[model samples]
Target: MELSFLSSPQIFFTVFTLAVSVFLYIFIYHQTNRRKTNYPPGNFGWPIIGETYEFLYGNSEKFIGDRMKKYSPKVFKTKVYGEPTAVLCGVAGHKFITANEEKLFRVWRPHSLQKLFRAPFLPNASASIPRETMVNVTRAPGFIKTEALIGYLGKMDTMIQQHFNLHWEGKQKVQAYELMHRMTATLSSRFFLGFEENDPRIEKFARLSDGMTVGLHSFPINIPGTVFYRAKKAADAMRMEVQQLIMEKRAAMSSGIQTQDILSHMILSSNPAAGRFKSEKEIATLSSALVVSGFTTPATALAIIMKYLAERPDIYDKIRAEQMEISSSKKLGELLNWEDIQKMKYTWHTSLEVMRIIPPFQGGFREALRDFTYEGYTIPKGWKVYWSVTTTNKNPECFPEPEKLSPTRFETPPPYTFVPFGGGLRVCPGKEYSRLVMLIFLHNLVKKFKWEVLAPNENMIGTVIPMPGKGFPILLQPLST
Candidate 1:
């Protein structure tokens, strides 16, 4: 039978509508089945978005605390952009994930710009930078022959001496955080890419890269006049600069010249299978990552450390004595080495305590991959899980008198209770490096100058990292030789 022209349109519309209806029904059914059977209860805030709005605007910490009190240490389920999430609180919950980390915890894929910023060109860029690569580059070593811990110590000492001369010369009063950021940027560039002081690109890259932390939580839309847009522009400019450096390094390598920077190491090292080393893009991206990860944490920690010292004059005196003991036998302009830092165990402990109290990445999120049962609640697959390192550190049971700033508590605190560097396979690879930086800076600061907080009553604000609103200024007095 011949079909009428009008009837053909009617049939197509009816079939399309029917297909859509069936698809909708199936999707709804699947989502309904995927819903938690008896998941840990918590507020979802608004529909679909769940607690994302609260999280984005800085209420997540308080929200998590409130839920912990009401729900009592369980997996609190919620959603972000319609994605399911679970937040594990209390000692048991923390232990469960850390113990079975490989299975229970996964690095929630970092936001897109993270992947773009890490390795921009790959189609599957999100997955392109392997966990193994990150572990190797950020941590110690793998098939690639980056320096181990001791090598890091040597470099750190040299960098510390240079930084001291640049910023802390003759007891000048400086903004601790500002000096720290500049020093770290310079030191990291010198250590990572072997850039000289005259390399203007380092300062530009630092400016752009620092803004990236702000971009991570911003809306994904890169429309003109947006923060993300500016970040992307900055990233592109940095990338171009890196490309130029890579070409220069490659040419230098071709001529059999070996430089002492990370770029030279990357160029010379080969993959186990005899493949040429990491691409210039990869090197540049990784170089940027190293700087981004290292710069802020140490700078923020140094600021906080200064704040604590300023508040407690007694502790300041004790630390000063310790520095003097280390420096008493050494001459001016002599570099303090790794062995010297190791002698300042008390300083290390104090820094550790400060981090526990104020972790840089305060709360981390992970998404569930499969249905999981916890405390009579079934957390279905695809739920985003948040673990608050800050709040957990404050738990009274785990840390007696948790609010008090006591470094000695770490000498014997309940195991797994204080994870400022996070836990699991994803724990920060730069932990030891950060430790060395903080110890070295504190050692010198205490020895050279007496400092007191300019505004002890100023409130600290929380962002991706926490810092005092008034920028931790201190009145500095030079010590007599």
Candidate 2:
């Protein structure tokens, strides 16, 4: 009876249909996943923790270079910063992320950064401060207008002049890191917040900034003794203090007092894109973000540039001549204008090369919004993408004699390769602003003095923003007027 039942036409038909359906389903699933799950060739390190120790505990370049040697150079898979990371190496990798942003990827701050600089300073899970306001206040016609920037040239020139008069003019010996940091603080405090050259805010802000910057690259451990904890506390305090300053500025502005600073302008401006003026709290947060991003980097870079210039007289002479020519064009007691800054091409290139060899800002991080393929390897959705400047900055193919310093290399560097300020929509909004300040400072520095680094072979200690290991003690020889 059982055999007869199995042999029935109805039973046979059902059995055949089920088998075909199963076969087709398996075939389709395998075909789809074969394309989707073609993950890049690299290990995730260990079980839950991944390769976090090897990645963070040693020289990052060696860690990355070793992986590229073991796997493919273009892209590789590993877990870092508590996420599955696709480290994009070389010029192609840098270009890929810059070109494909918003399509396959979006700006992603590390969770550590998010926890450290929460809302107002940075919008939750956002890549940067409000895009429109940051752009408008930085470069747009309505806000700190192009002409307004021209006005700032005079102010900056005076500040640099005063800075030298106070610090660099009479001194035979100085520490590059401390001096550059103070110079940066002087400009940032005065220009960003309208603090005077002698204001105490510089010291306070410096303290707050130090605490936060030290923890920027630390793991997000919130224990009382950890660096991350101190960073978070400092960041929180900075937010409160900045907001207080904003409140004071807002109250002052309401009474028809004259105020001409970045913070004041940010307060006065309305957001055309967002269709409303930013609140004081929002403005405070954005201002802090700008100061934090734009502040320390220029200082570190200036110190590095000084070290290079101190070591290379040919480079310094070219810059010295450029500044002298510009100064000759100006009348006695006359301040430098925007056009003078434009003529500093050689000086600018020299600075650019220094940045390339030792980038202060490094490259940024992004999140993959969806599954994407690059070089025939799949980057799964939600995986973090690391686009690096260090990898491309030292490529012998793009830069001939990668270890050698050559400012002329800037003339021939291929696109998306020499990214000191990074590239694409997420590029440093402070690029123009930084250029203005750095050039002005350099103009004064190289013109008035030729310095020699006492420790000519100072090694860098930090990675995120590389600082001279020895603080770059230098002997300053003043130029006769």
Candidate 3:
């Protein structure tokens, strides 16, 4: 054979070794350079991987709480998402983190979320518009308005009855999470894109929503066979579907067949006179966000509430009584109105208590805008920060016996103590919309049937939202007339 320069095993081995050596040198150098004086005390763990596996695979709260006990209660440091992070815990920490939005810290999504969502209109450091401006556009009279919400109630009631008839009417057993997920997806689809519940596209959108949620906390790797890779694919599919829907809806709008769904609202609001105009891409992204947020959160919340109620019959009885009272007030074959929702005070209180115990959105991330000190420790500029709802919600100081289910706590919740929907300028705009979804669903669910969770002590577990492990299988029976 002809001698080939540098083709010897020895030469190949030398090059491989040099590459490995250089990688290690660069990794270690970056780790060393990232440290700062008086940074929150906690191990950075192994290079690259850091404490992500431990943080995600196990109880994230305990991981952060254990560090809080070891290092500091208010703030602790570790590496997650391949970056050094300082976790802020407790009511004080929540207040500090949320109250100082944009000024001290800006909204930060993991690379996976950025790639998955890719909504340029959303609040982020790179967004052209201010976060508050986005909020105003969403809250504008033309979008999710009071009149529009009132119109949604009758349709929701109809959808709920139809969903029950199709899915739960004759079934002796069903998975609460699975069923609720489907129902919410249907409702969200109807609202967002005017898609029918059984439209095949709703199921496709639901699958993509599930993928996004499951892959949210996963490592942001693009390699084939990875969770984030699948999620990105799902996102791409969802975007394509939404873009096509936007075209159809825009055509429908131009034809004078005005629809009152979210897409239509977005189109109408884009008029220059409305003082807000989002590009079709931004509208699609935002609409998909509505579908995602509308589907998963209320679904998780409804399932958890049902689980708790099944385990606590007395609470269930009270809720049933309240709902039964509401049903009695309505005329025969009448649908729910906005006033019907206002009267569900006690039931809403119970839902709030359940949320306190297990928030669907466990917490969120923020990135430091500049070097900032918290309780004597310096969080260096560009360091990621996490404000934990689990930590703050379960603080004994905030809730007398944090584990105890007490709806009375909401009678006069302490300021900044109970933040299921977050706090300050970054408060969720869909808060009322979520409440309506839950309350309406609860009303319909209770009036129709009583269920018992068949899974023994089925606990919640997932990075997306803590959902019951067995999907919370339950035995269903119609309530006696």
Candidate 4:
């Protein structure tokens, strides 16, 4: 009654051979599929898993660079997060993505991000608010205008001065990263929702925002007790709190209140295209998002700028001299104006140079609107596209002596080589806000304290936003002006 002679004596061997063959077949199929399609040169790695593990845990630069070396340098195909992605490298990639928004591509928030925004526990108001919706509201009024920005300078200067007066002055040592993060986070609460400097709610807002940010760039492992789960819960609480604030602001405005914060502005401003004021829900959505996302970049920039200042005293002295010159012209207690900011060119340049060497965000991802061809390779419709900043930011041809920490490179940067805030209609309006905060913080810093980096070669982690490994402790002393 045996199926065959071998089947009777070698059941284990037969089953083992079948499993290995199936595994090899799947591997070979995925590997060979690149050639099978009109796709770009590169393998998709193993089936199901793909190159995702390496993409997450391995070196980001090397991940792209290794493939570029082995395959065509222009474009390559790979799978990450269970999606086929086409990575476009260098300035050409930057130009193409920047120019082609809504034409051939669009902003592609990860499913995880979308899920975070629309969690079940959160209110349904945000469900209708797309990323583009926020952009439209940004153009409506407030925050994005130069007049509004100029008006904010004094408040920022005062806020930062007070921040340092309490947090920095007389402190023997501090974690530079934590210090900057606290400053920026508090600034976001005050600017966006008009929270007072010493409000207990500011602390609550910062803690909740930190919780929400934990899963923005992480995977969607939404189990009962995962980080993502906690992030979702934090988002719910944050949205509820912001909605309550919006309700209060609306009532105050109705009764002839005249306050000047981003929330009040949004409450009164109308979307010109729609010719109506943004709904309370819409205003709440934008305010909550700004509070959560606004502080991160400026905070990171300040921390890195300070780290570099400690490492290079010559740069520090140069920046300090510029700040001193500006201060000399101003009366004591006078806030920094647009004119003073313009004069801090070298200081701004230093920040740019630091950004070039270590960009805050590597780049953003986009989804193909339609099938497109670039560099003789086909990028299929519905595929994900990642336009990298690291590729162009570090390009030697674009930046001669790219590795050098030279702020003067910005005096005549190569055309379209580095755009820290992105370009075109897709450009983030928050960039101006970040610029003002970082420069104002620097102005206060150079005028106030000289710090020492406790751990110069401290290992940094995180591919997008690198942070010190062991710790980022620094010793501070007030400068005897």
Candidate 5:
């Protein structure tokens, strides 16, 4: 009787059923216990892949906004790029994470990014300089701060003039995006690497920049045909080029051929006795990051500002008038200076409005150093957190009639509400640098020409930064002298 029962198909089915029931009971119990720990309320999507596809492929603002609507406005849980991530929204979220820098939270970049940037020990490592500190040092007084910034104006002016002569002047139509990209690239090279616009290596840097931007937010796949793989390759090439440049610059410095740009500064600081010293490799890594970050945002912002100006002739007239007033104060052939940049108040305000209307970067990431609670929700350790300027900047509570491009709204607003360059301890060090460059570009642009947007209603493609749909073509109308 026992042998016959064992051989029966029904008995086998019964055994399988029992096993499944036990498994389900154990799983449900574990999940129930985990839920009791009170992690933040929201969906984590599928295992591994998570909502990363939706976040990357779709509109960043809408994606986060919809989530905020569905879940808690302060924070929500979603996994992206194979990591469990919590997105922190609004003013409170921005303050909480930014204020807790290096305490309960630290900057986090994915493995793919760490590899691409060639920062072997990032996030937190004893041997490495913290990213913020590194950036702040690189942006100190003689680097990108006021003294160094003032010096860059003439060089930037020369580059812009060259850009207009080469790409804009005498041309019926020029792609604003392409021209801005080149101009920004040239400016970055001059300021960061001490390279002239005509230097052959400038083209190489620019091309590699394109590859790096494409890969910044892509999937971490490193397969031959993948965007990440291509980006890594480009980074590798750029890294090598930078290393050579550092060596050359070091040699030049040793021979008393001093250079005033960032690379030269880093070389001088490489002394072990100097608390702010960085090794050649470290210097190169920072320089590569600088090139990518330095140009992309300002270039994108400049293009968008130009587009908005073209659409609003009244606004354009005001900016042009202000710029002409500044130009009139300067002698012919004289370049802009620090004082001139400060005087373009209206032009700068207009730029702020454009940034608020369409931020160049949608958001940024931070990682939890320890488990923390936010608005009564427990955020576990080893989790990634995000803060979006877009979320807060567009909130009607923060900005009345948030969609409007009224610069006057900036006359008075809630503190930490409009953070185009981010805020708190982690605020972008290049804020002033970008501001100076933008004002210079605008002053030169409006002084020399008036342009009409050829594609006013074109769609915008959002990546790590927003880009014009049609490369933002414009018909140049040079202003009469």
Candidate 6:
């Protein structure tokens, strides 16, 4: 009789007791461990999501910079993009990240991209391509291609004139961004694929490349109809176009046509034994990446430089005077060779300063593959590391009076302090090409037109790439003959 009475509520009582015991154990364990180790000081907002909301809302850069000012030059921890990212600030950290230590860090590749853009040839939905392949495809070829590019530039004067005549005429305040996109596309097509100015395929490829960046800031979800989906489709189309160009160039080369475009150079290159040439697919991928990466950078840079010039009439006057002095003896169609570009050292300096102040890739992310220590803090493995270009560029210690746009600042800054092209093995290979294009275009524009900004106040929007909020509108007045 006693046993039966006890069994009625016994099961409920036992379950309640177990739950209480587990909660107390977890609470005690957490409190004890929290006091044991010294973690980097940061605001961990909540469990799981952490400080991701701040970053998603666009305050990450300002917040990180503010924290750096308060914390000094050292390693600190904060959550970003749903992960714990170690924020490295100041000059020393910049050196550490861009130096040989970069080998120890992994470039951040989003899972969404990996899933969507599967191996190019394989249909294995779950298979991921090697990281090296991605790097090779995206890496800009360095000074090895300098001589080839210079030769191409020397022979492309007529093409440049043709583009200007076609695009800049009968225009009532054309969009600066649109003009830049067209210019870069046309010039790049001629240089890379040997396409004539009127090639319809070349024009289509340029349009697709320019549109690829539109949806980059959207959510990762690739619904039935979304920007990401459209971008991927565009990329696929561009890839096919590139392949066709490569095949056509290869055929031409085999038949001894000996063209002087980038395609010809790539196909003709070989190791000492006349073997080890790039495959058709490899060549296509590399060429495609070059067009996509190369055009966007110079186009955006030109737009920004023009915007600055428009805002400050005094600066515009100086630039115009310089350009006129350079063009005094040379004719309008005369090719501006590389040596000529290099001779304009002041212009180069000015461009460098602009990039330092407003770099295209504002923040770069790297993941730690192993635990590392920086400034006495142990950065655990699997944490993301970030270097803020905008913040570091503005650091007064490295750049004295960093706010001022003085190109002379480069004369005394510390090494690795101003890395607009980045550093180490991964530095942009297209640096020479970009510099050449910018100088020639700027010199010609200043000589031909006087321009003014359409709107000065609404040009401060920031995203992955910073651009004028109102699309860099400008009113162009043709120069007197």
Clashing pairs in 6: none
List model 3 lDDT by residue over 448-467, tens digit each: 89987798687778754677
TM-score of each: 0.84, 0.86, 0.89, 0.88, 0.89, 0.79
**lDDT (Cα, tens digit) per residue for candidate 6, span 310-329:** 76677677777776776675
For candidate 5, write residues 1-481 as lDDT tens digits.
4446365688889999999997887677558646665777777775558788898879888888899999888888888888888888888887777789889988877655666675443434422235775676576635766777676778777788778888888888998898898888888888889996789888789899988887888887888999899998898888889999999998887888977777777777665554444466767877888888889899999999998888889999998898888888889898888788888888988898888888888887788999998888878898999888877878999888888888777666677787777777788888998998898888888888998889989877865577887889999998875
Better of 1 and 3 by lDDT: 3
Best by lDDT: 5
lDDT of 1 by residue, 1-481 (tens): 9757668789899999999997887677546645734667765555445566666656545767877778656667666545667777877776777775658556664454454465543446654344556666543433123335456565566666677776677654566666787777776777667788657776776787666656656555577987777766766666677768889988988988877765566656635354323467667776666666667768777887788778778777777888889888788767677678778877777777777766666666666767778887877776767677756677777777876878788677676777767676766776666776778778777777887677778765655566567766667787764
lDDT of 3: 0.80
Between prediction 1 and prediction 4, the one with superior lDDT is: 4
> After superposing candidate 6, which stretches have Cα over 4 Å from the reference?
1-39, 43-60, 69-73, 111-144, 156-158, 216-218, 250-256, 260-285, 460-462
Rank by lDDT, highest first.
5, 3, 4, 2, 1, 6
Output the lDDT of residue 97, model 3. Answer: 79
Better of 3 and 6 by lDDT: 3
Query: Which stretch of 10 consecutive residues in model 3 shows the poorest summed lDDT?
Result: 125-134
Q: Supply candidate 5's per-residue lDDT for 291.
A: 83
Which scores greater on lDDT, model 1 or model 2? 2
Total residue pair clashes for candidate 3: 0
lDDT for each residue of candidate 2 in 294-409, tens digit (9 for 90 to 100): 67898888888888887788888888998999999999999989889999988988899998888886666788888878899878789999877778777778788987878887
> How many residue-pair clashes does candidate 5 contain?
0
What shift in Å separates residue 375 of candidate 5 from its native position after superposition? 0.6
Provide the overall lDDT of each model, using Cα atoms, as 2-decimal numbers: 0.68, 0.78, 0.80, 0.79, 0.81, 0.67
lDDT of 6 at 143: 25
